[model samples]
Target: MEQAELTALLTAQGLRMVDEIGPLATTGEVAAAVSRLRGAGHSPDLVAAVVGQAHLRTRAAAKFGPFADRMLFTRAGLEQATRLEIAARHAARFRDAGLTRVADLGCGIGGDALGFAGIGLDVVAVDADETTAALAAYNLAPFGEAATVRHGLAEDVDLAGVDAVWLDPARRTAGHSETSRTRPEDWSPSLDWVFDLAARMPVGVKLGPGLDRGLIPDDVEAQWISVDGSTIELVLWSGALRRDGVRRSALVVRTGAAHEITAASDADDEPVRELGAFVHEPEGAVIRARLIGDVARELQAGMLGEGIAYLTSDAALTSPFVQSFRVREAMPLKVPTINAALRWNGIGTLEIKKRGVDVDPAQFRRKLTLKGDASATLILTRVGEGKAAQRLALLVDRV
Candidate 1:
């Protein structure tokens, strides 16, 4: 949104219209609302901003939940903003560590800072983008004196008296929709600077889950979090915020329940074993944290193959760390062979999963015409080693 549109949206008149219009979820809904809004003598910019924000709130519901209804967002901000549930967890760490005064650097749309302020901490949130800072201030208005928003570079922010810092360095270039990923060195508040600050103070740095593990500092606790099945982020905690002896952590959150597995370092991979009754696919966070071996031990399972992440065991054991699937049949990884098996099993809907193999499930699905009501998950993978290795399809059911 332009500066003028934002100015208009900040007014009592503009926010009122947004609440009345509610969410314009569909393109058709947006068009009809835009036409009505324009016919009512609203300026083109105001109409555009209101309509766009309404649409975004509907989309943002997935991240912000009901809080989205009162919040304004840019396309990029909504995409990068931490989910409310995840943000709360970040806040709890600071509170538990007795760090009350917090600085949320690179505070996009006040997502994490809201978490801080909501917990009664004094939060000074800073954003490099002027518009984003304004929206953050607006979103955090309910907290009164507990929250402060500033439009400035994160590195320039004076951190004097701030007991703890939650640094979320901007990873994407500046834009609403056309932004691109920037190299780590290009990130605002460079990783080097962030790490230096982390060493001096209690700090929590939020980074992309896929960030290279080698770049992680040896002293900080690295926590990889996954919401549902998607690995969302990696958080590095330093100083007092770092839990004692917890170097690698995997936090899995499904619905509202959360489970965590922590270790001092990467756990050793268990030895490979023959395929058994149950095959387990570890959660993304577990794989990212390199804690697959810890989970494997808990389930009395071993690696399915030397390099593969899948685990197998005769026992049908399960845990929050992995999605357990019971093996039904195994066959050559050939289109005709799998197609015949699908037909024989009366399978119509198929969930094609592939690991350690080169195959496009969508394109490969075209070769098979499933015509029955049964549904099953087909895991295409390679088993064994060297010349003995062979590609095979394991038909399985969710346990």
Candidate 2:
């Protein structure tokens, strides 16, 4: 949305009209709502802005919950904003470290700023985009003096009184709706400048989970966070914010509970062993944090093969870091044999999972003719490497 439209949408009258009209789900509903609003004497620009915001707010509910109702968002800003639950955890780290004030550089729509302010930390939220800064001001209005929104370059922001810094570099091209991934070197404020600042003060840098490990600075604690089974982002904590004795960590956040596994250094890989009765798939965050070997050791499990993250053990083990599945049977990776075996087992529906293999699960599933009442999971993978490698299909059930 343009600055004028955003200004119009934030007006008291526009907000009331948006509330009265409520959320518009489908395109038909949005078009109808726009027609009705224009019929009621609202300008086309105002109607369009209100309707678009209503839809965005509904989508934002999944990320910000109740806070989304009153918040204004730009399409690209909302897409890159951190989830509220995860941002809260980030804020907790600052609060627990006794930090009283923080500078949130590159704060898009103030997602992390909201979390910091909610926990009583004064926030100076800065964004390079003017419209986004205005929206952030609107969203952070509830915090009053505790939150300050500024429109400027993150590198230009004055940090005289700030106790800590949280930086989320713009990793995508700047646009309201159309954006593409940008190379790490092209990041706004630049990683080189960010790390330079980190050396001077406590800082937390948010990056993609798949960032190259070699670029990570020594003495900084790198953490990978996963929410609801999906690995989200990697955070590098520096200076006083770095946790003692923890160099690498994986934080798993589920519906009602959260768990963390930390290590002083990367764990050694477990030895490859014969296929056991159970297979363990390490959580994505664990794998990203390079802590899959730690999980393997915890469960007394061994690697299925070199460079494979899968673990196997004779005994069924339970751990929050991994999802354990009971192995029913194994066979060579052949479609006809697997189809016949499925038919013999009365399996009608199949959940296909693959790793360390080239087979596309969707395309492979179509080749099988499913007919029966039972359902089962099929795992396709390579058990070894190079010339000695063997393709295997294992039918399993969740533990």
Candidate 3:
């Protein structure tokens, strides 16, 4: 958002009007709301700013819950902002480590800073963007002197007396709605500078889950976290923030519960074996952390194929780390063969799942003329090696 709009949106009158209007879900609804506000003698700029914020808050509710209403956000800030629940977890790491003060470098919209202040830690939240820093200062105003927002480069932030440093380097040049896959070297403050800082202090760096494993430092504890089924972020912990004997970890969060599996070293992979009665799809966090082998050992399962993430075991097992499915039928991967198998089983609706293959599930599912009342998951994956390699379709049911 531009400076003037931001100023207008954060005004007492704008906030009151936004709260009164509530959330506008559709373009038509927004237009209607705008007309009503305009008729009520609200200025055009005020209506536009408040309406936009109201819409963003509605969307932000998924990440911030009720706090979204009180919070101010930029389009990019809301997108990059850490979910409040996840931020609380980050705060706990520092609080448990006996750290009372933290430097939140690149603290967009003060999402993590709010968590730090909420846990009674003194926070110095820094953002490179002036407007974002202003919004952060406004959002964190409730904490009074305990939380402070600064507008500056992360690398230039003074860290004196800060017990811990939290760095979320800007990884994308575009807004949150756009793809933000940038090279490590392109990261603001750069991974080089961030690592150098980590070496000198207790540090926590948040990165994309898909970051190249080779770039990870050996001394830090790397944790991959997935909220629901989506792999969210990879957190690198250094010094006292790093858990004892934990080098790599996968934290899976579902509905109300969370499960974490940690390994001191990369877990050894179980040997590839023939297709079994049950197939387990390891959570995305586990796969990203390269700890799927540990999960396989826990389930007494073997890799579906070398270098493939899918696991198979004859025993029926259920774990929070993997989504287990029961294999009903296996067939050569072909449209005709899959259709025939589905027809034979009276399967009408199919949940197409694919790995280590190029086929688009949605496009491929459209080709099959399904009939009957049954529903089942169809897994497409390659098995075997070299000339013996062949794609197989596994009809499976949730265990």
Best by lDDT: 1
Better of 1 and 3 by lDDT: 1
Name the candidate that leads on TM-score.
1
Estimate every model's Cα lDDT from 0 to 1: 0.93, 0.90, 0.90
TM-score of 1: 0.99
Candidate 1 lDDT over residue span 26-108, tens digit each = 99999999999999999998998999999999999999899999999988999999999999999999999999999999999
Candidates by lDDT, descending order: 1, 2, 3
Clashing pairs in 2: none
Off by over 4 Å in 3: 174-180
Over 1-399, each residue of candidate 3 has an lDDT whose tens digit, in order, gives 766777778788887887888887888888998899889998778888888888888889999999998888888899889999999999999999999999999999999999999989999999998888988998999999999999999988778889999999999884534546688899898999999999989999999998999999999999999998899999999999999999999999998488999999888888888888999999999998889889999899999976789999998787999999999999988899988888999998889899988999989988887998999999999876566667899999988
**Span of 10 residues, lowest total lDDT, candidate 2:** 382-391
lDDT digits (tens) for residues 232-319 of candidate 2:
8999999989999999999998884799999998888888887898999898889988898889888889988768888999876779
User: Residue 274 of model 1: what lDDT?
Assistant: 82
* Cα-lDDT of candidate 2: 0.90
Clashes of 3: 0
